[model samples]
Target: METVLGIDLPTWWFLLIGALISGYGILDGFDLGAGAIQLFFRKEESRRIALNAIGPVWDGNEVWLVIGAGSLFAAFPLVYGTILSVFYLPFILFLVAIIFRAISIEFRSKEKMKWWRQLWDISFCVSSIVISLLLGLILGNLIQGIPLNAKHEFIGRLRDFFNPYALLVAITVLSLFMMHGAMYLIMKTEDRIFARLTVMANNTSKFFILCFMATSMATLIYVPHMTDIFKSHPELFILPIAAVLIVLNIRRSIEKRQYRRGFVSSSITTALLLILFAMGLYPNLVLSNADPQGNISIYEAASSTGSLKTMLLIAFIGMPLVATYTVFMFWTFRGKVKLEEHSY
Candidate 1:
């Protein structure tokens, strides 16, 4: 039970894994958001510009998801195994969406035929929307708890994953991503496309705000237990408060025509929301509705202390490099997207 600053190693790994997942949500989120809004740009040039805006970084952004999944598998094998087994279908669908998105981006510009381009464009848009919804749906079910027997085995049917709460969450997530993507496009596009996306961003911003408020109300009214931790630890209330302010700032920033600031606000908002989620689910990787005692505690699900320690060191060395590369890529490609011969 190696401890860092009074917290145990498993808890640290839990935080690390959560951070990685949050990183994916923040980085890849904009990419998904961008793709989700793809079909909205009507003209061929507009679509190409939107696609090229994310071209240099979309695949790189996905690396965060890969690393996050790897961290989960390595640090909490039990939780990983149980979650994958329980939600196998959604995860597989998520993968398929990711693949379609990647291929659509690559293949869309390869042909001059209008039908071929349109087909891939449609695939890209649908896949992106599906991916965002699936991510939210998976998270929603995790929050609500699954049917796990005494042996920690999933006893629920696949249909059980599509509960009301999960559906609401999925739509909320889609709205959030759409807004986020609009902000990114506003930053990366100019002139006609810029004007078009500004209107889209404003509309999407309203959509997100409404969905967020609804989701918050639903969570508080129905899933009251999630707020229990905040009640017990009032200091943690700052996180949600900050999240609200940041979300508000997103709209304000956009209104002020500070597109980059709006994008940054959106990214921060994503991170904060994920942090709040992790805070609520702290110490429990998965809750079992069938058997309360069968809930997968982080302590029980974690790997050996030695393994956590070693991986922490590896993460320390590796993560910064990945982050640095991410920053470099964005810095390298910063500005309005231009369609050249080499552009996607």
Candidate 2:
């Protein structure tokens, strides 16, 4: 169905889901990345400080994930069900990681036993890494597309999920998150830790930048006709070009020791990457080399027009409030985490 603005309801629904996922990546990506790196914070006090840096904001950051999922269920139930069913094990593992991390975070502080706290710390770090990898895998699967039956249901065994292109995509995303998280650590912490984090950020960002470019080129080469989208629509190349410029800026910012600016630049690069991805796959939500017509387009997977319209209205009204609250929470908690000597 069409909207008052002249666009179809399904278009808006797709836009909503895209925005939610992008927002989640930009917000929670750092927190999860930080948690992953916390494993290396060998000193118990250092680990505690790292945890404190994200403590107040992490829960709020996760809201974007909830919003993204809710938007998918409400606006594009078909896509949601297909994805969940197709990657059932990965999704389950992701959920388990999130749950364990949350539990460990809360319980870690309450436990006075050194071994107990260490166990909790390990759980938090390991879970973060798992969740981040699973997220990347999910995106990889989408890019590679799943095996769909005549009924449009995914009908492949678990082994089908493993492919060169998908694996590359997963590695690229994992590296991106690691860099993003390191940049955040540089921005949020101070003293020697911050300096160390800055060095880590620089190294990881360079490595990931190379990996991203390499994987992107390889994806185009390995996946026959994968570059067709860019070739047919040359305008789409601008997104990646802009992404490269942003990455350059991130490097310069880091070199200058402008941690905040570096973080922002990295985020912009991430945004550009997401935008390019969305544009590259436009019209088709999922694409498969095996079955050309099995492609699931946004139009085919969206909810009913009336339902989409109603949800759009509600989202328009509520999304700003959510954004406001999120920003306020971050602002309230803005500061470097101090060592125990400075603790209240």
Candidate 3:
């Protein structure tokens, strides 16, 4: 294994990949949540307001996903090829949903016809819901383990990816997104819409809290090796503890009417949960259910030392630029959305 600043190159890439995906989840999640609940807004102004809240920056948020996938290809081509092949069906649907989401955002306001707007509205909401659900399903399947052969091939059927636990995780993710979206809407709204979004935010938080608790218990009981690191190294228990504390603080901030703080807490909670998830898998990027030897550990699946070094250097230069652009975009679009003659 090659070391970069005392840490192995493969491990660094894994952490980088996890952080990038977590960034995507946190950034895109609120917009997805907002779209998921768009139909509930009733009035046309309310729906337009919710859409505008995320309009200026939703597309930029997806850049993280592109970077994540690109990094995986550069740093661990084997894992990229194998996991992607296994997830081919779901990924295809995910792409379709992405296309629909983009077009819905662009085409929704193109016409004034009620049917035209309704059609795009449904497309936007359904696409957002499916995208979020599919992301959670992929994660759940990864945590539960995929059936790979000795050659690192997926030998399982599609049904394996659609198990009950996966669906449960998907529901929990969707609920969390709803809560996150509600918080964003509350922050970017006023008067009646603000009150409505606030109430929904509270309700969604309750829903996610229950689902999260159930998922945690189910993982302990049904999912194997998930808590192995925590059980062996008691110190690692702090990760889950911190995650719980962050989740709890979300409600506290909401109760205090600090919507911005509440949203930040939720964002941190999302990142924390992802870190804990990465902890559960540790050295293994992709786990195998049938044979432990079939697992794709970070070292086993990483690129050559020279390639890793070169790619890492590029990442160091590139990621900061991406982060800066994201910060600038959000900062530029900060504060509540006010629709004018040319609003989304």
Candidate 4:
């Protein structure tokens, strides 16, 4: 019942968790996208440059994910428990991909053998692609509502995870990440690599636009609930309009050879899209496909007020430090990547 500003603690925690997840999507998304498109580099030199581009901060980028998961557990234990229990297989696969992707980056250059390097290259690309797709799959299913029983337990078949809507969302996410990664790469390379990435960035932008259009059409047609909030609150329609404008700017930035601006635009577009999603799913952390009564509202899933209050205090004290460290890390590694003897 305790409030921060005008909002209650649970709602504050909800917004905080959403912010952390958005941070993870923006930061880690580019590296994962870069990894997904690494194999397109062809030569070993090109691949190494691509790997080195993300090497200094790839692992650090995952800190947001770790924090986000921990926040979910602390803030909404019921929702967390149900999600992990029901989506056990997908979560496991996601963890495996994370592990493999990390190892691929670390071990790719440990050997000079063509086959050895190629092995990790494929692993890195596949793992990155899988991670992006799985993220989308999870988001899509969450938006569509899960088959939860009266107890808020997942009772759906595993096959339900692969429904057409979820698959479409997954592909859309992959395309978005690829475009995001390409923009990052363009900012961090020169000569042939820069030129190559420019073409790739533009192409991926088109690909993302195509997928985004399809996903928007599908969402309007199939997931009417997602639009309910906007319909009821006509003023909120600006968020999607802003998102569309930002998305358009990404290509404009790229066309002007403003890669950093393009990257920032991609990041903003990502944050806006997720914000729209969170707005649609507001109040309900997890929806129940089986029964609307089973839906786990944020108020229902949240911990005790005392716990939320204490965690909020800790978050305020701790989050700025995390942000500072992230900024310092990125600042230290700023500028186009250069291949050195010890580089990736």
Candidate 5:
């Protein structure tokens, strides 16, 4: 195997892509989660505060998703095409949801009419839920294995994306997002709204814990392949152990009224969970059930070694710039949101 900087090109790109996704999940996940439970804030002021809390950074956060998808396409065109083609319908819905979520955020404060604001609030909440569910569905299918033909294409029926297990994963993801969002609200609020959000945060945390436990049990009992790495290399078990502790820390931090710490814990938990997923799928970018031999390994699906080397150079230069921008933006927008005449 040809190596660049002590690692194979394909493996390096895989790690690169995964890191981008982890960035997306941590950055965008809370905003989506905040929107998922928007209707819970009955007062107009409460809703405004919630919306403003994420307003400044929500759009910037989605850049990670765009970058992750583009990186996947650039690094492994075959895997990109095959997976997108497999779940085309959900992708279409996810795209629409993203557009509408942005629209709702912008248009909600454009008018003072009750009906107008109410309409956009519903739009924002539902679209956020849809985006989260669709992401989980795609990830679930990847974990459960897809029906891919010998030609490296999806051969499953359109409805295959809605399998029972996939739906369960959807529940898990939505619940987790809601919890993450609540923590963000708690961190960015004060007064009665702060009190209100703390209660919601605690409730959503329990909801997420339930969904996550069920999802984990289902994966262990039904999706045995996902755990194979842990079985073969006992050291891999540390990922799950770390994820569990982080989840507990989220609850403990919230109980201690440490909102920033709780949010950090949630972010770390998100990264650990994705790392676990990557560990399970390493080497194989997409698995095939229709034809057992049709699996698209990283090496098989990746572009030429020369192309990957070039991409590695671009990624090394580009990602740090992106990270710096994200950090600067968040630091600039830090603190509780205050609604003003210019505020959205």
Candidate 6:
């Protein structure tokens, strides 16, 4: 098949899938994080306020996840097959967490009984935490490179999921989500709930900074050739520098009780992380140290040129509409959530 505009179809698909997943992480990360932190509130009214704050937008945020998975299944079947088959356990756990959390969010508000609400709250919090950790672990595994055989299939055992580097990455993601959640709470709630969230943001931000540093150090030591990328591409250092600056700004914003500034800083921090991830997606999607020649470049993994052109046309028409609706929904729901109502 002739290449379209000199670019292969598979490469375009990979880029699309990557963008979708990353976007989902940035948007939904805060909501999940907020749900995880919901455990700290003792007052039923405060909990209601927290839940209501995210109620309108949480389900919409999940749309990006569905888009990402769908794109992978339709466009990059090989990558999807490998990931789903190899990471079966984590995948199942992630789905279960998402399901339970959704149920908890919907049911908690209907019940007037204290015990029933508490049970759902616990489910929501725990599920959020687990999902966030699993996402981190998946990223870690990808960067570390799964054990692929001659057929480019994963030969890794279940125990490999608990490796030290993977665990550190999971911690880093968990901390980041907590920080993101605190920022969302700062923006969505007011009065005593907002004040409490401010304190929570300050503490969580510090914890995340520590985890980020530890994860970076561990990745440097464990992932071979990763340091070389930094050394060779000195320009990439700007991303981490910007991330650090944003972290400091978040701290400053919290100190001044500027919720808007804090939220913006958190968003900037998330952007910086995404940039750093992009920096690592060089030469190939899955790098193999065992067989250097086995690296799966975007060009090699792509579909036919005709298929890519058609997909691009569809994306051009559909993506903008999706973005418009998402923005409109958030704008309509903008403002502080009150505790008087019990709906999520």
Candidate lDDT values, in order = 0.90, 0.79, 0.91, 0.92, 0.91, 0.80
Model 1 misplacement above 4 A: none
Query: Could you tell me which residue pairs clash in candidate 4?
Result: none
Candidate 6 weakest lDDT stretch, 10 residues: 287-296
lDDT per residue as tens, model 5, 45-159 = 9999999999999999999999999999999999888877888889999999999999999999899999999999999999999999999998888888889878876677988
Model 3 lDDT on a 0 to 1 scale: 0.91
Which ranges of candidate 3 are over 4 A from the true structure? none
Each candidate's TM vs. the true structure? 0.98, 0.94, 0.98, 0.99, 0.98, 0.93
**Superior candidate under TM-score, 1 versus 2:** 1
Q: Which residue pairs overlap in candidate 5's backbone?
A: none
User: For model 3, which pairs clash?
Assistant: none
The digit string of per-residue lDDT tens for model 3 on 186-293 reads 989998899899889888888988988999898999885989998889988888988888888888888888888989988998898888889889899999997777
TM-score, candidate 5, is: 0.98
lDDT of 1 by residue, 105-207 (tens): 9998889999999999999999999999999999888888899998899888989999999999999899889988998988888899999999989999989
Tens digits of per-residue lDDT for model 4, 188-233: 8888998999999999998998888898899999989999998789
For model 2, which pairs clash?
Answer: none
Per-residue C-alpha lDDT of model 6 across residues 1-344, encoded as one tens digit per residue: 44446755665566676677777887899988898899998888888888988888999999989988877766656667777887899999999999999999999878788899999999999999999999989888778877776577666679987888888888888888898899888888888988898889989988988998888788778885665677897987777778888888877887787868887787777767765765576546676544665566666665566666887789768777777888999999898886564365
Q: Looking at model 5, report the run of 10 residues with the lowest lDDT sum.
A: 152-161
Give a tens-digit lDDT track for model 2, residues 1-344: 57758877887777777887888888888888888887777777778877888788888888988988999888878778877888899999999999998998888878578999889989988898888878877777776667886567676779777677777777777777778888887767877777678778888788887888887787667654545677888977777778878888877887888878888987777777777667767777776545767777888888788888789999998888889999999889787776564331
